[model samples]
Target: MERSVEMVVALLGIVHAGAAWLPLDPELPAARLAFLIEDADAKVTLTQAQWLSRLPVGHQAWTLDALPQASAFEPISVQANDLAYVLYTSGSTGQPKGVMNEHGALMNRLHWMQDA
Candidate 1:
């Protein structure tokens, strides 16, 4: 949370573990946060201890500080078609829409950006 190193590591860890990460900005309203959690059907939520109590119900909260550090990690196979992450639209018009991005698509976009 708070755009720190732990947040980066958590995002990478989630995808590396073959799980799609749905990042919820803590600054957003409580109703929006609850809506996102409900729509995503998220199971575990990794966040900082300070923000733990703020999260809406329905997630098994795991504080980033509690997570192991540089622990032995085994890389899992992730296919190009596999889900990479789910990002929500700004919802300026109405309810935010979840955009499911696959690994292949994300990589392609990144490569394109690099070329540009």
Candidate 2:
């Protein structure tokens, strides 16, 4: 029952106003995480203590366990058009894709029962 770090981070980011980057191991050190943070222009990085200390300055870092406490600061109001997720596939070479969905999409799917 191990949850994906990416999914957990995305959820936490939406809830707590932060970004999550999964670390790379065995292949390369911090390569994927670094690229994603840079590409996304993430201000805060939610990661392990070792990864946090190694990253460039100006990044607010926190561990997974600390996310709940951090998310309590402010409530984010998600609008109908707000982004729901950016789910990435687990492929070799790690090509990440964003799966953007909204409240409208969810409602439309839920209301399909009427037509069926």
Candidate 3:
């Protein structure tokens, strides 16, 4: 959750499972965190054990320590138009706005960056 290898793996796992990921900064204020969770309607949050108490009520939190071991995984089918991730803009106008990105759009941007 605080920019570590676990965070990377969790992100990969989310995308692999054909679910969109909304990364919330751990250092954000409690109110902001609550707002983001509510706005995103997040069902599960993957974080370390220490951060569990910080999460809002009703949201499920899973720590890496408590996760079961897996030998292999099957890839979930995802279309190019499927939502890949949701990024929030810095709330300069008061409330942060969520920007939804599809897999195709993100891939195109990545390809353009490489060519540039």
Candidate 4:
């Protein structure tokens, strides 16, 4: 919510768990957020305690402040081709479209950038 260090940690946690992370802008309309959450079928959302009330009903969420202090977690095995994240394009013409990206694709892009 505040773009603090917790946000980065949460993102890293999601990736480390071998699950795709979808970011939803907090400034977006409540209806839009609800739509995206439903569309993504998000099982859990990470946010600050203050923002918990803004989430759609029946949605499961975890507050960063309430998370355990321990950072250690078991490694999850994920293939290179497994999904890494899903980003949405601005829905200027209509509803936003989700673009899926694979871990291998992102890794390749990052490697290319470093090599260049």
In model 3, the runs with Cα more than 4 Å from the true position are 68-74, 113-116
C-alpha lDDT score of every prediction, in listed order:
0.84, 0.51, 0.86, 0.84
Q: Can you list the residue pairs that collide in candidate 4?
A: none
Scored against the true structure, residue 84 in model 1 reaches a CA lDDT of 90
Model 4: runs farther than 4 Å from truth?
A: 68-73
Better of 1 and 2 by lDDT: 1
Each candidate's root-mean-square deviation in Å? 2.4, 6.3, 2.2, 2.3
> Residue-wise lDDT of candidate 3 within 1-116, one digit each (tens)?
78898888888888888888888887788889889988988878888888877788878888888975766777788999999988999999889988889999978998999999
Q: Which has the higher TM-score value, candidate number 1 or candidate number 2?
A: 1
Number of residue pairs clashing in candidate 2, backbone atoms closer than 3 angstroms, sequence gap of 3 or more or interchain: 0
* Lowest lDDT 10-residue stretch of candidate 3: 67-76
- C-alpha TM-score for every candidate: 0.84, 0.46, 0.86, 0.86
Indicate whether candidate 1 or candidate 4 has the larger TM-score: 4
Backbone clashes (count) for model 3? 0
Which residue pairs collide, candidate 3? Answer: none
**In candidate 4, how many Å is residue 76 off?**
1.4
Tens-digit lDDT track of model 1 for 1-116: 57888788888778778888888888878788888888988877788888876788656888876965657778889999998988899989998999989999988998999999
- Kindly list the per-residue Cα lDDT of model 2 for residues 30-113, writing each as its tens digit: 555555556555566555544555565565666655654533355556566755434444546566543456655655776997
Show the lowest summed lDDT stretch of 10 residues, model 2.
18-27
User: Which TM-score value belongs to model 2?
Assistant: 0.46
